[model samples]
Target: MNHHKITSDHLQKKAYVYVRQSTLGQVLHHQESTDRQYALKDKALTLGWNEKEIRTLDRDLGMSGAQSEKREDFKTLLADVSLGEVGAVLALEASRLARSNTDWHRLIELCSLTGTLILDEDGVYDPADFNDGLLLGIKGTMSAAELHFLRGRLQGGKRNKAERGELRFPLPVGLCWDEAGGIVLDPDQEVQGAVWMVFRLFQETGSAYGVAHQFAAKGLKFPKRAYGGVWDGKLIWGHLTDSRVLSILKNPAYAGVYAFGRFRCVKEILQDGQIRQRVRKMPRDSWLVEIQNHHEGYTTWNEYLANQDQLERNRTQRPENILPQAAREGLALLQGLLVCGKCGRRLTVRYQGNGGIYPIYECNWRKREGRSKRSCMFLSCPPLDQAVAERVLAAVSPEQLQLALAAQDELLARDGSLRRQWEMRLQRAQYEADLAQRRYEQVDPDHRLVAASLEARWNKALAQVDEVRRQMEEFCRQQTRTFTEQQRQQILGLANDFPRLWRESATSAKDKKRMLRLLLEDITVERGADREVQLHVRWTGGACEDLTVTLPARIQDRLRYPAERIDEIRRLATEHTDAQIAALLNKRGQRSSRGKRFTGKMIGWIRYKHRIPAVELKRPDERTVAEVASRFGVSHGVVYYWIDRNILPARQQAANRPHWITLTDAKARELQDWVQSSKRIAKRSLKRQSA
Candidate 1:
């Protein structure tokens, strides 16, 4: 028993008994093992150590000794031994201290230096002695090797059971054990319905987060199975979280497959110089066992694989640049589907205008890489979106009739859900009204105080019932007011008329954007010669369509005006003022070559540029304000109103003098008509207000 290892010097110092259990389950259920470890304190006292000198460390009771980092009690014991404070280190076995050589050897080295004795049920060993040290080293090595063998055997058993679809773990929501102890769908219809709804919605929306959002919007909760104690296996309802939805979606079990080893333990060194373990997901192919069609499930294995692919594609931050992302609720129809032909990079969408109604597609790849702005590819969204939409409509016209019928069915289904909600509200209100009336009738009329309150409550409840009834009637009326047979026929007739449908208020921008993403894989735009943009459309099936689209020229892009228009403008500048020239040019439909309507300022600019002389209006026949007003059969104020509004031109000789108005008979007639039109509008507005 190595009695020589125990010395008086060791008895003078404290004895540290390190106790641990590998798991919480063992700590709770394996009380005998814990008692055995703690009984080592009596062993230390039997070895001539006083009761006060014996200290038990059970802080690592629910922690694994396979790694030393998590064992704080073990660390404290080692520190005391290294500081020459712990004279004897006692444990139930070497494995209880550590199953790793790094930890065991370190503790042994510290004990050897501190002249501490190691004790267990077998015997006591002094690490300073060569024979005992060698034996303890063997014990430590064997302990670590035993752990490896035990783990391998357990893992092998698990894999075998999983391959046979017999291994059991915590089932996700909607699955539970049957009376016969076999896995089956949850007996609760609501739980089963919720689980099925999540899968159905994911199928419809092609997004896990979208499914959670749908549940939240509908005020529906997801069921989670409680794991332990009184609540074990019970269903707990909560608002569905995105991660929970994703977990459900990603689990192979939901697809009737038994899969194991989806995750692997990884060791990481933390900032505190300790090892940490994390469970990281492994690739599906790397899973140790996968048995398909193991049980009844919500989806097929093939559908599960498709869902995985879809989720991968839906990621906006994929490292690979080739994959397209899900459609965002942005104004740009081609937001995630556009690419720059010149740069071979994705184009970013920038929204402008009030409410971000206008979208601009720009390639900022080079700019992001710190290149000059000249490398950017820019295109206004309206023209490009129109061009692409026209092409898409042409490509999809054959299926438009089928899609229209399906859309009509979807609308009816949505209305059915809404109608059910209204009906529920109506029923609730009717019940309240009936209850209030019954309560009022039961009240004694002579007790006026209570009778009055009950009557008022009854009246309020009646009002609520009426409001709900009216709302239900309105809803029913709206449901009945669907598209007429003739309208349906017209819609069918114009199934291929996408332009008209796109412009219709019934079509949402979101639906349009989703439609574009579904049809087109990517559109590459490159600047071409002669103010044209070359659009290379890659359709979903790898079909490519190339089109040359003309970019609208800006006013500044016009090199010069036509020589004939220029000569007319110059001549008009000679006899007419700038204002008169503009009016005359506009009346003759002689707009600027840039397609802008001529204004007085534009006329002056052209006249000044060409060195044209200003016109002189000094003739006696030129009518002044009072003369013009008399001629127009209107007041002086009306004439002045027309002049102020630029309908007529007037000049002043001095601030105090009357304004001189020059008017041809045509001008005088236009003024009279404008004044009469304004009066009629004002009179009509007054009549409407009074009515």
Candidate 2:
């Protein structure tokens, strides 16, 4: 290989000038680009090169030298040098040519192979010179190390500042850095006013999308983009919908707690061949810092929390398409009132199919389980046009209104009483608990007598406290029950008006199901044979009553009789324990007025039907005979005598076995009759009076 000896005179012979700035922050004027160009030209001339032969590389603005292969200007200049079109390469310094060791060495190797000379303001360094090349290598390594160190130092400083909560980034609107210098409220009232408007708008509209559209239509200018771009819907909506932006509005940070490090960014390589950034919330304990009274807050914490709850509710409610016009009008009243009868969940309204004509109110729980399961519950979707309007009209009736007012008053009074009672009981319980605690604390563990006494007292006090709390709860329920009848009347009045409203109201207005929900609780339709449909109307507050006021007398009669006969059978069953009496009645087979069979359920129903006196029943597991006797209001001797005498009926006697009874035939017959009659066969009535 024939190598040529390249010198400064052979290199400074290019015409092009390549100027570069590493970043937008680095101004070409500050670095004196013109001066550097002139100087490099002069140096080339000094090296016996003409001005026309001089070439300057200065087109690398907004470029970094971290990767030399990607620097377009550098690559072009190298190409010219390789073609021997350039005599020498001139720069202000070696660092300007390359800030990386690898790129520096590669340049040197190219220069040496292509017989190109390199010159800087400091000195001309020919690649052919062994000592000069070694010096250039050392300078290149130092340059690279300095760049690395600068980056490391910068990052370390940022991390330290962040840990101290002093690190500042872009303020996400509704906020500004403190004038004295920390995170603070924006001084511009206009911006703060806009923030307030966003919250108010959300509350009024009950929709983020609606609010965004309103702002867009009004041509509201979003906060000036920090990046110097015009704001569009994305920016406007982002500010309006951002959780952090809302957080700031709610945060006391404005009232002056500087909360920091609540979230962190994690970087990961995604399948799309790009690095993605994800944010994860940090725990409260891990928060970087919280300095109170940091700045003026735009809203109070309470107002902010309220706004958040409103936003959350809006998110959970039906979409615009699903919400009827009427519902939209009375949304406030019906927002959380309607509930599913089956799953005890809220029923959500939805529009089905393309035309959006098939409006339906469905239980989300049932829908999620699919159509088959939907039938398991009484699904009620009375047409929005008639049913809803009628229901609402009924709900707002004078009678209903009166009942509602009465119920509200009653409820308040009851609640007040309950609250007072609960407070009194709670105070007593707390006092007792305190006393027990103190006693427990005072008792020495080593002293059995003291410990035992304390334990017993503590147990007794706790038991009493529990009992009082239970009583308080029961009392509260009773207070609520006191208003139930009134609530029912109000509900009935509301439901009764629905049919009228359905007939008179406009179809468009009828689309408002939510309005119906405000007035009526539920309207269920049951399909029967012969194309007969039964409508059951349950008012908002009352027990469900069949609204089919014109039910066939026969059906009405049937319903009335089933319940009545069931009750009658239960009464008779309780009076008689005699299976024979039951059998005789079965043999006689007298049909109920409804012509339904009277079975064991009817005969023995009284045992389960009527509330038994607590004193009459023995607790299942009472081991002590005295306890059992006391529970039944019987003497212990009587209990023992019953056990020993086995005076139990034949069936019960069989259970007691040979140890208890030696029954004569006459005694057996008497016991049998008692069992049949469910009455004690009186000894006086018996022909043979044998003990």
Candidate 3:
């Protein structure tokens, strides 16, 4: 019969062997795989099993056994066991099958249902026995706990290392791992050169996207990924544009200092299958560890910081992809640098009509839908542009530079004098303070001396000292004058070179913005008749005075009003009763320059010019006779009689009276003549009465 050979009295059984590795560090040996099959086959043959019934599973190399669901051979083995295809299963250890309690329990359940026996190096386990099942469960539980404990211990060790600033993970781009230390520079300087090139390119193009595109087009390889390695725009741009990675280029850590735990994260899971909250960075002081001069550096700290500052300025001034073509052509030097003087808003360039012939800069904010209140008082003046450029160049010219350098020297000398004066004043104040303290200590406690006397004297001395200190501070502030003659010469050289440099050199939008700020102080544009325009340009050097155009009659009237009259108008407006005076003027056929009638709004304009505070007036009935007399410089009885007779006009009576009477030399002589004439008339009248 084709029955199995039964040497011993027990039934022979077929068994399968399964092997696995949990981590990349572990390797499967050919001998191990072959030996496992032979051992299981030998044991089965010894039990009188057929050779063909022996099956081995060894293809699942380097696969983890932590989760049964992920193990292919384990799943197949369980299925075969459940179908009763195998009577027994064998392995080197229980952990080799599964280190998770849940997975182990599932295996045990399958074995018991299929009546399959499990044999390990320790002993054979009969799943049918209650005691054996319990022992197996306990072993599985211990194994899983051991795995968890091992993981916890490993993580704890890593955290401790991080606290000591010795933790090492995968090195980021522009850095490499060192066997002696932890992270260091790449042995090849080519990568570092490339990194510098990237920074320089960013400083030139002002766009990370453009930089990445350029790099990719040039066939430069990006840093390799940890998994599935390939270079693409996203990866290239991600590394090139990452603020974190860029920060590393500017970080002092690689200069031989340890910096660790610069970031923290709060763990949170969202219902949408995403991690909502994570990796919140903390302050630098809160970092876990810090050590100075940790490794070799690719760039100096100053250069790195400068690059970072430049990058930030670029981010603010140049939006990504907005000026890609302009960047490529090196045009649009004034793209982000120009601003409208009238509206104090940024100006953007526009190309209109066919062939884009007309290029004009217009204020974006001034062109809003409802911005018709003022018909763009700002004018576009090309002469203003040329004038500004010329003035800037002239201001930085050799002679001008010499002047600036001289000015700087004068400022330095002034600063030194001021500093000495400040020191002297500070010393004097300290001495005074000390004297006050000593005097207070020397005073007799029993004497009935007024404390106010001492306080007054101390306050007076302190006030004097404070005055001197304030003068010194003001002197110091003034000491920050412009460059000296030599410095001005150097700056002039730079300024003279700027136009050419800006034209030829590859400068970023940020650089252009800085240049504009340094060179041009302000640009004022005025619209003339027939759409003609005039520009007033101001530059950094006080040498280039602001252009003063002959203003229109309307504007000139506002500017040239007599100071005294303006003050009077402001004072009257503040009295609030000036509204009646304004109404009187309106009634008298007088009107404002715009031919508009007077209103309360005009009061504000008048008051603002006069720099006077507004005041409320009392009701007419509340005006006392004394108060009316005081206002008009008349006797109370006279004021009352006038009020009773109603001789004076209501507006004149309500108006503020002059504080003091004044008579010029001519007016005084005229008054004397009038008095003499009146006396002669009086004498003639007396003679007639006598007759």
TM-scores for every candidate against the unseen true structure = 0.66, 0.40, 0.41
Note each model's CA RMSD in angstroms.
25.8, 29.1, 27.8
lDDT by residue for model 2 over 1-691, one digit each (tens)? 1114444446445643445556756654456754675466665565566677766676676676665655778989877767767656777666677787777898888877766667666666778679878987888888788889988899788768766667786655767666556666566787777777776676555556656666777776556435454533123333343444345444445544566777887767768644456898776577767665545666565565565555555455442222212234322233333454445555465555597644455555645667454532322234323433454565567776677678778778878976897888788897997899798988778999888888888888888888888888877666654446766676566555655655555643423444454445554545455434444556656767553322234445554435654554455544454343346566777554456655544444433545421112223432355543443344456446655666632223123222222345675465455534643323322322342
Q: Best by TM-score, which number?
A: 1
Winner by TM-score between candidate 3 and candidate 2: 3
lDDT string, candidate 3, 1-691, tens digits:
2123222222445677676667544563445643564476566566555677767776665776666545778879888877877777777778778897877998899888877878777777877679889998988898898888998899789778877667876555567667775777666566666765766666555556656766767776445324233542112323344444455544555445567766775757668644344687666578767665556666555565565555554453442212112222222334444445565554555666498754555554544646655435532324444545565656656777667667777878788887987888788886896787667667776653755566566777778778878887777676776554686556667856876775565766445545665565445454556535555555655434554333324446654546664665665555555566477557778566566787656755666665666655544335455554454344455544554465432223333632222334564464345434666544644564566
Better candidate by TM-score, 1 or 2: 1
| Pick by TM-score: 1 or 3, better one | 1
Indicate whether candidate 2 or candidate 3 has the larger lDDT.
Answer: 3
In candidate 3, stretches whose alpha carbon ends up further than 4 angstroms from where it belongs are 1-14, 23-25, 28-38, 44-49, 67-70, 78-87, 106-117, 123-134, 152-292, 300-484, 489-691
Residue 473 of model 1: what lDDT?
88
The residue ranges of model 2 lying beyond 4 angstroms of the native Cα positions read 1-38, 61-72, 78-84, 98-117, 121-141, 158-179, 182-191, 216-293, 300-691
* Order of the predicted models by TM-score, top scorer first: 1, 3, 2
**Global lDDT of model 2:** 0.58
